[model samples]
Target: MKKAFFIVSVLFYVNSYSQSESKKAKILEMISLTGVDKIGVQMMDNIMNSFRNRDNSIPDDFWIEVKKEVNSEELINLYVPIYDKYYTEEDLENLVKFYKSPTGKKVTSIMPQMMNESMEIGKKWGQELAQKVIQKLENRK
Candidate 1:
């Protein structure tokens, strides 16, 4: 009886592991099909570019090594758990389909520029709010 139970437990564990691996692979496929991983890689490149711009001491080889170490596969592995948490296999499939569409492709291409402009707008709004707060404080005093 004990041996039977052990066998059953082992089989269950193997099955569970297989399912997890299958899900992870599907999620990775969706990530690739949607160019989500490419976006992450591009963001990393932009960060590396900023470092290169801010300091001349770093060597070109340094950037190359950094890029190699922090490649798309690494980023995708890091993000797998987050994707798994938020999306099921069906959801990922739908997302992949959407991202392959023209509108989705446009959005993916423009996201970085949109983010930069949005940050500038947010900063200006924050500064305006801060000045108003300062004026109110002065008036109270």
Candidate 2:
């Protein structure tokens, strides 16, 4: 009976490990379909540009080497856990399916533009709110 229990436990562990690996692969596919991996690289580029702007003394070779060292895979791997925490394996599978569809492709393509425009609008709205608050404070004085 003890030997049978041990065998059962080993099978359960192997099955669970296999499922975990499958889930991780699905998570990677979902992330790639969403274009978040590309976005992560873009963000890294933006940060490097900002750094270059601040210090022009840095050599081009140094920046080139730095850029080469930046790995989007690491960023993508970080995202996997967050996604795994919030989404079930089934949810990831559904999302992967959607992202492969035409509408999902369109959404991924246009999302960056929409987000940029939204940020501009939000900035303007925030400035207006700030002015109003200042005006109200002045009136109180």
Candidate 3:
């Protein structure tokens, strides 16, 4: 009888402890703990700002041409609502936590610039490789 009573008591304690947790709050806590969403948001902001600052290096007329070809406004109209479905309260919390971390801050600050620079280098190398391959083919012909 004492063993049975002790078993029941343990079960009750476990049930109560678990019952006290709110699923929504638990999910939010998990998202804040993960911190990936924050990094992604920071990256997107950096990339958007980078494009916005194109200066005369990329002619604004090209943008006007592109906008005329593809109505970016219409595309965004169909696209923007997905954020409500995909970016939850949990994700926002996680993003906030990541934005506050030292490594996360460093990545948010410089990674986009590094990526842009590397892409330019990759394009340069690809052009060189294509020229070499073309030369080789012409020599053999």
Candidate 4:
């Protein structure tokens, strides 16, 4: 009986591990289909460009080497758990299907531009609100 229990436990552990790995792979596929991986790489490139702009002493070869060392998979792996926490396997599968469709492709293509414009608008709104707050505080004083 003890041996049978041990075998069952081992089988359960293996099955659970296999399911977890399968879920992780699905999450990765969804991320790739949505172009999030490319966005991460683009963000890295923008940060590197900022660093290069701030200090001209950094050699081009150094930046090149740094880029080579940077693995987008590591970033994607970080995303996997966060996605897994919020989305079920079925949700991820549906998302992957949507992202493969034409409408989804259009959305993926335009999202970065929309996000940038929204951020700019938000910044301007924030600055205006800050000015208003400052004026009100001065009047109160």
Q: Judging by TM-score against the true structure, name the best candidate.
A: 2
Q: lDDT for each of the candidates?
A: 0.86, 0.94, 0.61, 0.93
> Arrange candidates by lDDT, highest first: which order?
2, 4, 1, 3
Candidate 3: clashing pairs of residues: 38-95
RMSD for each model, in Å, please? 2.8, 1.1, 11.8, 1.4
In model 3, the worst 10-residue window by lDDT is 71-80
Over the stretch 35-126, how does candidate 3's per-residue lDDT look in tens digits? 43354445555655578696648876765564456443443334334533466555656665776689767766786689899999999999
Sort by TM-score, best first: 2, 4, 1, 3
Model 3 score (lDDT): 0.61
Which predicted model would earn the best lDDT? 2
Least accurate 10 contiguous residues by lDDT in model 4? 88-97
| Tens-place lDDT digits, model 1, residues 1-141 | 999999999999999999889789888887776677888877898999999999999999998988878757877899899999998777877777887889878887787789899999999999999999999999999
Colliding pairs, model 4:
none
lDDT of 1: 0.86
Model with the higher TM-score, candidate 1 or 2:
2
Distance (Å) between predicted and true CA of 81, model 1?
1.1
Q: What is the lDDT of candidate 2?
A: 0.94
> For residues 22-64, what per-residue lDDT tens digits would candidate 4 score against the true structure?
8899898888888888988999999999999999998899999
lDDT of 1 at 1: 100
